[model samples]
Target: MTPETSETTQAPEGHAPSHRADGRRFRWNKVPEITVYFWVIKVLCTTVGETAADLLNEKLGMGLTGVSLLMSALLVAVLVAQFRTRAYRPGVYWLAVALISVVGTLISDNLTDNLGVPLETSTIVFAIGLAVVFAAWYRTERTLSIHHVDTRRRETFYWLAVLFTFALGTAAGDLVAERLDLGYWISAGLFALAIAAVAVAHFALGLNAVWTFWIAYILTRPLGASMGDYLSQPTADGGLGLGTVVTSVLFLAVILGLVIFLAVTRRDVIEQDRITPQVAR
Candidate 1:
């Protein structure tokens, strides 16, 4: 999610509503509030996704097909629970994100590794897939903002877009570092620079908040993937040689700590006030 303190309340018709114990009612967002913690945890989860996918595929001998099936099954179960709940649950929400990230990586891996698809081709395919998802989402919902993900259809579109983003990120990241010979660290640096530029354009140059947020969101996937590869790959492959096990464990630990903090503090929970005029005042 994009980093911000609040969300826009107005939404088109068709959102499901929730009622409190006292019979008071409101429309709630399924996503967490956009904050610094949101971005930090997002990047960490992406890193974990990259490394954990590698660990399971290479170490556990799951192969790309096995891991993809496993992760996709897990993602479906988690998303089922997520959809049933009317509001965001930190554990459930982040779990879905992490699993989706892994599944997304596996999807791209299957195309490139198992099917012998070129990284360049996979990159373009995922990019176009993402664009199509975005187009359909906007056409159906009339808005692409995460803040407006209050309806089931909107939420479905959001997750689809996210999945494509991760797939695109994996393909594009590998294309630059592994396929193009730029190396992991340099690729990471390149993505980092791109994200920084988006941030600058958003804060320093008045870029549209929604556009900037999505741009940064797309960039962070490749950034995190490159970082994960740089840290987890063998030293002979130009990495620090921490290995996937160590890297996955380390990032998972951090993600757990942060999720706990957010859950206890409810800091990242987006209350319904901002999106509902009745509660806004």
Candidate 2:
């Protein structure tokens, strides 16, 4: 039987061994290995999420609440499939990311538009939420490295952290762009610079790996969102006049092509051995 069938059989008996003797051997679909393709497709997914959200809300006359509900439902479905997979599946992984990106943005947007929460307040809220997730994750797991995610609990923390990062990034980016009036292109440039600085600090300054990873992760959302806004907004709004549909379609095409390549190559698959941490006997 396939691993999936075996897992289902074991689940009812509470005997499914998702991990090995190593501390790292646990039943969990691990996060994908970091690669150039990972970052490339992540940015593409983020851009698609932003433009797609806007397109559905504006072009389809769905309104913020309607589009948010639609995206949230889709996110739930993608996440369910992601959780069910026994291994890292690139298509499922990226699909989850793209859907979460939309949901995260919508969360912040709803707070601002419907609840009258200021950008500053939303930013602070999301930052605190992210901090709480990190604290809980570290308290339970002893480590927050994405590479170490190999258990159901750790994977739960991982996705929660991801959701918060996207939400936090959305709030922070909007604060800089709208409240601070940086404009879309300028906001994108600022986030790009910030991400570059984080990379330098991590590679050259001996920064903590987990810290660097989360910092970069949060920054990518804003960078991608800004790029999306810059491309999709009307020329009067200082954008390229591409419109959300065109911009979303462009990024979605890239995401789909890259996901297909990763599926065929299995380049992003997380090997079981890599996450199995050695334990003292």
lDDT of 2 by residue, 23-47 (tens): 2234444577888898888887778
**Where does candidate 1 stray beyond 4 Å?**
1-24, 276-281
lDDT of 2: 0.81
Model 1 per-residue lDDT at 258: 93
Could you estimate the TM-score for every candidate?
0.87, 0.88
For residues 59-136, write the lDDT of model 1, one tens digit per residue. Answer: 878788988898899999999999877677789999999998899889988998789999889899988988999889
Q: Which residue pairs collide in model 2, if any?
A: 19-25, 19-26
As a TM-score, model 1 comes out at 0.87
| Residue 25 error, candidate 1, Å | 3.2
Q: Which residue pairs in candidate 1 have backbone atoms (N, alpha carbon, C) closer than 3 angstroms, thus clashing?
A: 9-275
